[model samples]
Target: MNRDLREFRRLERLCLEQAALSTMDLARTGLLKVADDCRAAAEAIEARSPPRGAFAGAVQALKRAPLAWRVGARS
Candidate 1:
């Protein structure tokens, strides 16, 4: 699960960066799909109850991650 979340974050960052530089429509579309997959993975992890408060908080933060991140804005 942790690995999945980590991968999601990594992919999210990569997608955002690529989106910021991508001028081609096909590349942008592909990045959008990758972003969507990352969100879905995060949502799936958020559905589980973490055993520790810190883990719970992390999960919540992941769930609450701002839209700006997807658009390459610092948040």
Candidate 2:
């Protein structure tokens, strides 16, 4: 999922770059629209997804827990 997000971002950049280089108004407008759509999609996905470090945060929280709070703690 992270990889896919990065790919969407990369595609947005590529579209913007190509738009900058385009000589025709229509082509540039189309490319810019495509880039905007990619950016919007990426933002939407990112907003709905957990942060990349969410798993690490969970692990860190577990580390802070008392030994007895961990799994398989003895009675």
Top-TM-score candidate index: 2
Off by over 4 Å in 2: 51-75
Record all residue pairs in model 1 with backbone atoms less than 3 Å apart, i.e. clashing: none
- Please give the TM-score that candidate 2 achieves against the real structure: 0.65
Which ten residues in a row are the worst by lDDT in model 2? 63-72
The sequence of per-residue lDDT tens digits that candidate 2 reaches over residues 12-70 is 99999999999999999999999988876786566566545978657545644653364
Cα TM-score of candidate 1: 0.61
Model 2: lDDT of residue 63: 46
Candidate 1 local distance difference test against the native: 0.77
